[model samples]
Target: MKGPLFYAKILLFGEYGIIKDSKGLAIPYNTYQGALKKSKNLSEVSKKSNENLKKYFDYLVGLETTLVTFRLVEFKKDIEEGMYFDSSIPQGYGVGSSGALVASIYDKYADDKITVLENLTRDKLLKLKQIFSKMESFFHGKSSGLDPLNSYLSLPILINSKDNLEATGIPSQKEGKGAVFLLDSEIIGETEPMVTIFMNKMKNEGFRKMIDEDFAKYTDACIDDFLHGNMKSLFGNVKHLSKVVLDNFKPMIPTAFHKVWQKGIDSNDYYLKLCGSGGGGYILGFTENFEKTKKILKDYKLELVYRF
Candidate 1:
């Protein structure tokens, strides 16, 4: 059976700060997507995927009477018939693998939680977040619901504050020497433990202050400069953001890339940041000159996202 497809998402800016109402931006990353499908033979992972989805659907079904409603019977029947996610998105890669699955399940099963065809207003978005938080909590111990929301909407979501979000327009990429790219670590990173470490780090008043004063400032500036097409300001803020990640997010960054990450900061060639939780997986990079950054970091692969 064909089901609605949900794309992967990138939390371009914000990250941890969004939890505290810091400005944020997330964009749909179309490189990976997922859809529901039935198979004749289930691989071990597929079987596990289906089994996990059943319990998630049951949880959603249990919540239906109090919140939204859906076709639980059909959904359950579909699950019994080998329904599984056919997806290119990598799990534990910080690319919204679970988020896309959650989005697809809500689309196919939820009765009136949200409608893709309808205009998504602030109220609708909030309701969708509420439903998605419960659904996605199956993956992350706690979820902000931004990942599924971005994948489901397939739109650039701007987080103005904790409760405020809307579709936003990013500047068109210009043909230029500079580019934003993703460098794959070639290892999957689990989110929950990384987040646990972050929470533990938050207990330090000093670390908390850095997040509030330093990280938030640069992240907001990066989002603002990027969306407004202010390339000069974008690069300046990216430099600071790169340094912040290097200083505080050391544990999350893969060990091998630590030198590369620092080299960029010192040389002003390319700035790197955690793509997601960052123990491994993809690392996001910003360069004032792609040719220069590439030449400096020639050993690693890069996937360009935007140009300027």
Candidate 2:
């Protein structure tokens, strides 16, 4: 038997800035998705997935909460019967690989689960985010829960702050030269370590000031600009945000891409920023000329998200 599918997600704007109440935007990435399935004979890859499911099942069983409950007995039976998460979303690529799995499991086993078909109110959305944060924290030591929330609803989510968020609409994609894309770093990013670095930086008054004045400012403006279908303004703000990241969040950036990241801003071809927690994953990119940027970034792989 196969469970329902859950798509991957792209945090186009938020990244680390969301942790400190900066505005952020995320959209569902339909190119990659996941679902639960069972087989009588498990392949090596399936076996590994099954093993992880067993561990996650144990964690769920121990959770004490009123938010939601799982069908543990059925879940365990399925696990014993070679149930595993069959997925196409790449892990450690900052595209919500585990978040998709979390959404799928919640869809299948959680009692009183919130379906996407319902008229999702703000309170319901926040509740789901809170539950997802608790559920997804098993994978990352700390989770904002927005990843799974985006995957679960399969809608563009806008984060106004820690306590405010909503499902929002993005302007329809156009076949224009400008685009938002993903640049593969070809290196895995570990969330816990990167978050540790960010947390450490937050302690310094100077760093905190930059985040408040520069990072969050540009990030909020970029989100506002993009949502309003203002590409020109969006690019300008994204450039400023890129510079802020390069100057302050160096540890979160993969060392190899440092020059290129700066070069994107310097040459004005494309601006690259973190996709998730940075360190090494898919770096989010925005360019007014996709063809030119693609040629300049010829050695690396680029996945298009939206065209402007």
Candidate 3:
């Protein structure tokens, strides 16, 4: 048995800032995805995935909640029958790998699960977020639940603030020179440790102030600019946002990419920011000219995300 596909997601803006009630924008990234499938004969990879699912199933059974309930009996039966997640979404890349898994499980087993076709009122969206938060917390030590929310809906989500988000339309992609892209950091990131560092940093009043004032302001601006198709303003805000991340969120930035991150801000070729938690994984890049940015960073791998 195989279920439908669940795609990956990218948080275009508001990475850590969102933890502090800042606005964020997340869009579905269809380039990579995953789905649940069952096989008559399990291969090594599938066997490993199935084993992991067994553990996850055990975890879910212990979760205390009133939001959504899973069919643990059926889910366990399926796992024993070779049910496993067949996916291409890269784990530890901050591209919502576990999120897709959580989404697939909920889609297949949750009682009265919210379908993407529903009207998706504010209350429903929040409920889904709460449910996803609990499910995904099995992976991340703590979660905002946006990743699975984006994957489940397969639509752009505009986060106004904590507890205030809705599916919203983004500006149509255009074949313009300006673009949003991902740069492969070539290093895997663990979300739990990175989040721990951020939490520890939060003990500082200065860090808290920076997040509330600088980081959130630029993130909100970038989201507004992108939605409004205001490229001129978007680039300007992205520059500031990139600089702020580089200067304050230094620990999250991989040591190897510090110079490259600065180079983009210095040359105006592109602006680099954390894609997700950002100890490694893929770093999000913004450039006015994709070709020129590609030329400048020829040695590194680049993937185009959205054109503006």
User: How many clashes show up per model?
Assistant: 2, 1, 0
> Could you tell me every candidate's TM-score relative to the true structure?
0.95, 0.99, 0.99
Candidate 1's displacement at residue 72, Å, is: 1.6
**Which candidate model has the greater TM-score, 1 or 3?**
3
Q: Positional deviation of 218 in candidate 3, in angstroms?
A: 0.6
Pick out the ten consecutive residues of candidate 3 with the lowest summed lDDT: 171-180
Lowest-sum lDDT 10-residue window in model 1: 60-69
> Per-residue lDDT of 1-308 in model 3, one digit per residue for the tens?
77999999999998988898899999999999999999979999999999999999999999999998889999999998999999999889999999999999999999999998879999999999999999999999899999999999999999998899989999898888988999999999999999999999999999899899999999999999999998999999999999999999898999999999999988888999999999999999999899999999899999999998
Winner of 1 and 2 under TM-score:
2
Q: Per-residue alpha-carbon lDDT of model 2 for 108-202, expressed as tens digits?
A: 88999988899999899999998999999999988999989999999999999988998999999999999999999999998889999999999
Which ten-residue region of model 2 has the weakest summed lDDT? 13-22
Query: Candidate order by lDDT, highest to lowest?
Result: 3, 2, 1
* Residue pairs with clashing backbones, model 1: 69-111, 70-111
lDDT of 3: 0.94
Give the residue spans of candidate 3 off by over 4 A: none
